[model samples]
Target chain A: MGKRSFNILDVTLRDGSHAVKHSFTEEQVRQVARGLDQAGVRYFEVSHGDGLGGSSLQYGLSAVDEMKLIEAAVDECEQAEVSVLLLPGIGVKEDLEDAVKAGAKMVRVATHVTEADVARQQIELGRNLGLKTIGFLMMAHMAPVDKLIEQAKLFESYGAEVVYVTDSAGALMPHEVKERVSALKDHLSCEVGFHGHNNLSLAMANTIAAVEAGAAYVDGSLRCLGAGSGNTQTEVMAAVFERLGYQTGIDLYKVMDVANDVVAKIMPRPQEITGSSLIMGYSGVYSSFLLHTHDAAKKFGVDERSILIELGKMQAVGGQEDLIYEVAADISKRNKALV
Target chain B: MGKRSFNILDVTLRDGSHAVKHSFTEEQVRQVARGLDQAGVRYFEVSHGDGLGGSSLQYGLSAVDEMKLIEAAVDECEQAEVSVLLLPGIGVKEDLEDAVKAGAKMVRVATHVTEADVARQQIELGRNLGLKTIGFLMMAHMAPVDKLIEQAKLFESYGAEVVYVTDSAGALMPHEVKERVSALKDHLSCEVGFHGHNNLSLAMANTIAAVEAGAAYVDGSLRCLGAGSGNTQTEVMAAVFERLGYQTGIDLYKVMDVANDVVAKIMPRPQEITGSSLIMGYSGVYSSFLLHTHDAAKKFGVDERSILIELGKMQAVGGQEDLIYEVAADISKRNKALV
Candidate 1:
């Protein structure tokens, strides 16, 4: 109710580069680094270009060597401290030490709720080395609020500097975000962060919801790139924080310039809220929207065209594809072939 | 808090058509209508298909011949009763009556908050004719909350069946939608409907936010059609509602079929979330997102590729170009280019 306050942690090069095919040339990274640092972004999540845990031979984490990526961050980025993200079980203790030594200002450990202890162990190590540490619950929406609180408690005990609320499936609305964040805020001493997907088109809204509900930081990609619909957009949420009367410490326009000059050249333009994402949104399904919509189409014996229109509507009614089956079943009951 | 109620008003045809050039051949309308009707939508907002009123003859009212579009609705649409949208000060009462008589079950009058009273007179006329009516406070974001509520009450007194929280600029966040709808509901007798744009990429989230705040109906287009970022997609909102344990009568997959095959071919897809809209959004200046984003790009630009890329991030930021300008200004002040 009073002036809302929050921090903006931008993972554009790490996550946003996903929008650009996870392939930032050193030149491209340098260009975006200049803009992102100047933009006032407080944190730059310097990912290994590939997803974490997996060997460099794997797609995402493998795409960019962790050392090279960290070195780039260490050398080129300033103002916005460099934070490297790692999935638990993906990296060993040695990997963690090497990562930080390579110049990462911080390391965030990601894992499922059940694996919080495993993540906690690593966070403690990161902390002992004077590295700020964060813990990420990959699917915060799926994890019960209590489980999240409990897991975060353990992470905090293990010296996690921050813990995140992640809407992995893009399934949450703002109210849910508020309710969840409010609940989580009470249980953690460390800053609470948020990572959201745009599958249901709530990335910025949910991120803002988290901020307003007392999340200390919100995570965003340059162009919303990561997994399916990608992560919350850094520049967008930064604006939301600014408007709510809080300083996001980022220049959103400069970020957008990077999206134009560098990001687009690398990745396919973000898929707009297409029929599939929309349908998955309505279906109440928490699956990858692109994949689920395609699956639902085949399951229904309906053409992709038919599914596309339905996908948008389905997005609003999201649940599980089971709901899609239910809606389709209801429609089929009313009229066979629907034509 | 009490069962979390929300409405699913379907405006797939009216707004979605904007994406398709407002050119729904009779067959396309019929196809969409049949699919929508069976989808369980609460209301069908069918356009007069006429080009817009006022200045842009081609875009609004002039786009469609009212009688012809109605005839199409009567013939093609049977499931949902029609809510014909009319912009006040652009057209007259004659068209309203004509629309109702031609089989439009209801009429919606749209105008800015200051112009709300002008719209009330027409809604009054529609009510007098035993027609259901709604008063839309368009660009509600631009209108201060307290002022808009008073305006909403005026329509309620005039027998307006519904008072819509129209985020014409897609500027409102989920929390704002909750606050606005809650405020309006406290004062109004009629049901509250939510119309949204995707300029800030919060259309679905804001729509659901309205629902969570106890709004009875959620308004949106087919594929997030209409102005910038497009309207909330009917399919998307329906899916969101379904996920939240409510109902939005829409066939998710079936809707997609028509959207991809017929709608996509008809109207060129709108490239949403542009720089101007972003500047406008950040400035808290709500303008026409559709017109500002794609249309402007088509007309003039520094460069097409750069403008389009800028547009998406701008939308991602919710039309907050002022922040962008500020960011750019800050960078310039520092004697540095963003990227």
Candidate 2:
């Protein structure tokens, strides 16, 4: 088989900041960006972990403004394209403009899987601003293939260069990934992208499945440093891709060095599939809800698994974090009644 | 598609001993066995990391005799069938007999993928003893599909009940796994099994692909505690299988608890895909060679990747630990000459 070409949009500075409680400083962003740049990473994603305007208290405040971090990343990643994620409600046209002004060359307009309609304006604004626009449908596992296709079409209609089948919960099986990605690839005129989480330890496998299903863009983070068990480690993905005789156009050893020397130092903890994280994946809960659920469970004296199960039952999406606390309290009260 | 029923051979005690340097105590074996049995795991593999007679200077001596470990597992596992692994060059008939005496109801006679002939006598001996005999072809990625089928046939002719396309290096891609397993299932009269390592972090995906392609038996270690980055975590595999709507007759939470409370305590290092381990997968070197190569590299002041690449060129198989030292020394000498 011929070597397959794909884009690796690394979201280390963006999605990964959640693991560090959105506390990424400008210097840290610069260092990570510099490392990624040196490793020949073509796309560097920089923003608050929750996307633009996500530095507020509900998401967790960033130590430094995300715009500062994006600017630092832009300054350091001279050769790589700097990108930012913007959720529709949290980040409006102005936020996207601010990010583009900070030198972000690309913007991923994100929304809940079923709420792609909400992302239309942002994607349009991103494109109008002359930024590379990618549509990120968060919690994509919640939608069926037809629904996912319907949602992806909305992105395409809004002029998204890429439409992502984002496995926000790390819940999609490899077969499911194949089905969804192949269908999206078949239907969407725009290039298909995939973002995976390692909550079930299936990120690399799912990513590969997506690639085989003709996904042109894949997202990863250095050291797998995103929410839950984290995203697929970019270095490992690059290595695996090279092993399969595909060109990632990135130096495998350089990526490894960055993961080891740079990313490892910033990691609050080594990302492993914990019980809560596994439950989130198994129950198809959002990956970003892991830490929130843990906190809620502790605060309300309820089991974290119960909180996760309830959240999953509620079909909570990325922006629904307040529901975590509400669900925890309700469960805690119910359990008290039972006792 | 209808849900498929496949056998899971839990090799935590057998293969995972490598991470602990073949030093698993009888009590540890008993604890793990009891937990697995309670979790409804049907097959419990207990042996040295290098198989039956692997308690030697070359493979690293076990803290307790493997016979004792097997005996303990057999005693603790009231329902699960106790199993053991025996490599051709490392183990002999006497060792197989001893394992059977220790109440190992099954035995997997293992050999290099291309060297299935070496396992023949052990399989025959195991069958004669009325043990469920399995043929384990290690480092299966080294062989082509036709060669693997031919090898599987060799094991079948020797009275093996199952023939495994074991990805001992964790090198097999999902498609490759699917193709090889499908071919084996098509050609072999007996059931086909798969043993996966997580060197490239593709263990679970490859295992799923193998199952989808008709493999009957799949192997995983608790907490992914085997060589290199380790085997697929039994808990994660169980969770994934359950999420895929396949009944493994095991409680996912119980497996997770065992991994968290018991296996985590024993793990010397958390299993993450390291550069050396990735090289093992990329170069298709034996997973067990990771530690040996690392030690050799550090001792000789040579690059472990170089040693692994050289080993790949030489097509080194299991029981070739001595060759790692030789290769490392040769590389060091050549590098010195260059200087």
Candidate 3:
């Protein structure tokens, strides 16, 4: 096979913040960003776990101001370009400007897979601010390939530099990834990326399938410390791309060191396919609901899987973490009556 | 896509033995087998971590005699056919007969991917013994597609019922799995199978690729309780297959119960891609060597990743556990001198 090349967007500080309850110290961000920069990872995502303006009661507050974290990451990363995530509903134009002012060089405007229409203004604002704009289609597995293409076209029309098929629930199969990515690649002029979760242990494989189907940017986290079973592990993906004869440009050993040293220390818990995580993937619930569901399940004395399955049945998406408590309480009451 | 039907061979007992140091008690085997049998898994593999006669010094000894475990599993399983692994060098004809006496209805003859010739006698013996014979190609990622097809043909010539692309290191990409499984399916007249590990967190994705490429038999373990990052979780595969509109025959909720209740209790550790396990897949070392390498590294006070990388450099295949000690000692001595 000829050497295939792609860009890797490390989302450790952004997505991984959820796992640590968004309590990443500025020093933690600096250490990881510095290590990743030295390792030649060109794109680094740093923001609140839920994106700009996401530090609130429902989403859980960041221990440190996210701007401080982003600024620290930007200052420490000499070669790597800092990026921030912004969900259109959760963030506004001012928040986007604030992120840019904090030295974020790129901004990913995210929306639910079918809600790309809301992302148009955010994408436009990001471009107007002179930051590279990416359209992130979260919960890509919920929509079919044709719908994904339609969404990608919206992002393209809005001047987004890249569009992603983000498997937020980690529910996608390799064939599903292939179909969606190939569709987006064919329909959109901009680059197509894939972000994967490991709730079902298919993150790396799905990411590989995405790359094979012509994904231009793939997201990973060092040690897979993102949400639920976490994201596609950064070091593992580097090794995989290297083995597949891909020009990743990043040094594999250096990334592995970052994962082992800096990322390992900051991890709240090792990412594993726990019962709640497995249920999240199995039920197609959002991966970010893991900790909230676990806490509610424990508090209500209900099985976390039951809460996850109920949440999946309701088709709960991101920013609906309150549903976790409601579902767990209902399930606990039902179980108590049975007892 | 049309609905595709496939067989699931649950290897929770065989491959999972390594995780428990091959110490699966008779009751544990019986419980898991009964649950799986009730869940409609047609094939069950129960053996020592290595094979029939694998309870020796080189391989860890089982706490209970494997025959007792096999007999217990065999007696409890109502519908599922019991199978045993027989590595050519590790197991002899008498061991095969003993497994048959213990009520094993099938036998998988395994060899290194490049060493299929060693498996010919075992396959022939299994056929003559009136058992359903399977040819297991271990460490399949070590060989190229053409070499794997060449080796698989040898198994077919020896009258094997099915040939499996067993990813012993969990190192295969979905495309590679597609190439190998598709090749075997096209070249061999008999059925093809794929067994995956989760070291690269690609077990489910690789399995999906194998099925898409026309593999008829796929293997999984409950809760992924096997070597390294463990085998593909059985319940997860069932859920995935069901969602993809495939006829898996196994009950999804029933298997989930088995995973949550029985298999969860038996696991020594939940399988996640640990640093050493990641090195095993990155280095393409044997998945089963994870525990042995960790033990040697700890004993020698060397980093397990270094030992794993060195072993991978040596291209150590399964049954080469002794080399782990030698390499770890050398690495420890080198680090000491440098210090």
Q: Provide DockQ values for all models, in the order shown.
A: 0.31, 0.57, 0.42
| Candidate 1, position B159, lDDT | 83
For A183-230, candidate 3 gives per-residue lDDT tens digits of: 988887899999999877788878888999999899999989897789
Candidate of highest lDDT:
3
- Model 2 misplacement above 4 A: A92-94, A287-339, B287-307, B318-339
lDDT of 2 by residue, B33-71 (tens): 888999888997998888989999978999998888888
Model 1 chain B poorest ten-residue lDDT run: B48-57
Evaluate residue A131 in candidate 1 and report its C-alpha lDDT on the 0 to 100 scale: 86
Better of 2 and 3 by lDDT: 3
True contacts kept of 1: 0.49
Clashes of each: 96, 0, 0
User: TM-score: which is higher, 1 or 3?
Assistant: 3
Query: lDDT tens string, model 1, B1-339?
Result: 426555566666776655555666666677766666656565676774322232254444335565666667666665667778788666677777777677878777877765677776787788897877888887677666899898998888878888888886667866789999999889877899888877666777787778777787778666665655577766656556656667554666666665555555555654455554544455544343333444444444233223334443443333454443333334344543433
Best prediction by DockQ: 2
With candidate 2 superimposed using the best TM-score fit, by how many Å does residue B17's alpha carbon deviate from the native?
Answer: 0.9
Candidate rank order under lDDT: 3, 2, 1
Tens digits of per-residue lDDT for model 3, B80-107: 9999999998899999998899999999
- Per-model TM-score versus the true fold: 0.79, 0.90, 0.86
Q: How far off is residue A157 in model 2, in Å?
A: 2.7
Backbone clash pairs for candidate 3 read none
Interface RMSD of each: 3.8, 1.3, 2.1
